[model samples]
Target: MVDSLAKMVGSLQKDVDKSSRYAFQSDYALFIDQLFYASSASHITYTSLLATKLGIDLSLNRLVCLLYIKDREGMPLADSRLLYALIRTIRTRMTNKNQDIVGLLGTSRIVYCPYAETDFFSREKLENQLQALAATLANTYPVIVSVSVGLYAQHVLEYGQSLRSIPAVVQQNTSNKSGSIIFAEDHLVDYLLQIIPKSVLDHFLGYAVHYLQENPVVYETLQALVCNDMDIYSTATQLQVHRNTVIFRINQIKEVLSLNPLHQDSDRFKVILIYTYARTHLNKEI
Candidate 1:
């Protein structure tokens, strides 16, 4: 049964990569449904296979993987050396008896740590440790990490499905005034909206809400610049916009929103996040 399921999963993985073909494959949907059902049936086998595919050793019995990817808008692009160093550091921590870190995975400087438990106390401690490790890494590495925790257990498949829906819930929380989703401890969708100035939120939502209506060329230019940390002149040249015009639009955005584009990195990051959420889930865009 395991071998047959593995073969089916491998085939499904291949199909997933062939977007054009898979899009029209009725069998693909059936395959996905079956895969999830299998995952729920034997979560350990599924998670073990997932870890193997990602080239990580799953030695821990009760493990949870916290995947950390760089936030491009707020951090620099990752480098190979930095990623290696991070993996080494995490491995050392995981092996430490006090830390109880089990294994580490790395790809393009994104780190994944599989731990021994999902108990809230342990998870919170792990998060703090990871944050500290990230800070230490940032001093030398060029990237800043954003973590998404995925707890593993007998019901890991169910948990994984819930985690996948987080980005969607976050989007809904941002757009629907009446909608509420708990993003973090004591932080709900309505809470974030209430804390941030209404005018500022409106300014961000203005650009994000009507992003599709705006010229794709301009939108792409802005997104690339924000994501890649490209210089204004270079971005303008790529977009075929005059440098002065780029400055003008940026200035207008800052002035109207009462934010200084040059110094408001955190604010800019929030706006970019909203833009990303809106773009990825266009149908749910509020």
Candidate 2:
């Protein structure tokens, strides 16, 4: 009986050790995942094998995720839950070290594909290639390709900010109107584009929504004016109304909001914020 009890105890200890090992591996995998999106990289020999088997031109020095998710129900694809899981599965196939970075903005992710001693295309050439690739991706997917230059270490940070602002800048400025890829350096004019995040813009506009609701023409008139760079004549031409009509509504908006969105510097910013807010949210209410 003594020998049997000792054997039983040893068996239990072995099982507990095995469980602890499994737990450690699981926890470590979770930490690696946090690193992936913290815009940051690690080890697996499997990356090369998988790339060869898959016939993807995987590179170590530079790789971009170029996320392409097709539309669902006619809205921009924003199913991050599904996409993040897919990314994790893909990461499992990678052998990148800590220097490899990953970044996420909205439904998009930027991943640094790294390798040893091989410099990829120059920055300008890479940007052009990514832009052309973005055009092709847009045919089947609502794509927003954002890329950055400089070392992988610095590039990921810029890539994160660019991904946030580029799609909106391109959509507002370009005629194609669907999603497109843009290089961060090429679109430095995002500051002039009123590239406000939707949530922040919504919160700021909430204070004056009652005024906007009471005077709907003010919203329309404000939108046209800002899109035309605060020009009254251009706004009038675009709205197909007389220049005086545009001027009259601008005055009315000034009275209601207690600021002239057209003339005052602060009000110009406010008007752009409200215009962006309405485009993304309040238009549905109409």
Q: What is the C-alpha lDDT of each candidate?
A: 0.47, 0.50
* TM-score per candidate, chains pooled: 0.36, 0.47
Q: Please report, as a residue range, the 10-residue window in candidate 1 with the lowest summed lDDT.
A: 175-184
Q: What TM-score should be assigned to candidate 1?
A: 0.36
Q: What is the lDDT of residue 184 in candidate 2?
A: 41
What's the true lDDT of residue 282 in model 2?
65
Q: Clashing residue pairs, candidate 2?
A: 39-102, 40-101, 40-102, 41-97, 42-96, 42-97, 60-114, 60-115, 61-115, 63-113
Query: Tens digit of lDDT per residue, candidate 2, span 1-286?
Result: 9997567546643443343323443323322222223321211222222234434333444543344443433344566765555456435544444434333333444343433344554665555544554455455344433333322322323333434544544444443333344444443334334455556755767756656666677777777887799999999999999999998888887776677866689888777766666565565552
Give candidate 1's root-mean-square deviation (CA, Å). 15.3
Please, what are the lDDT tens digits per residue for candidate 1 over residues 22-89?
A: 34533423332322334433434544455455444434433334334343354434555656566666
For candidate 1, list the clashing residue pairs, or say none.
94-101
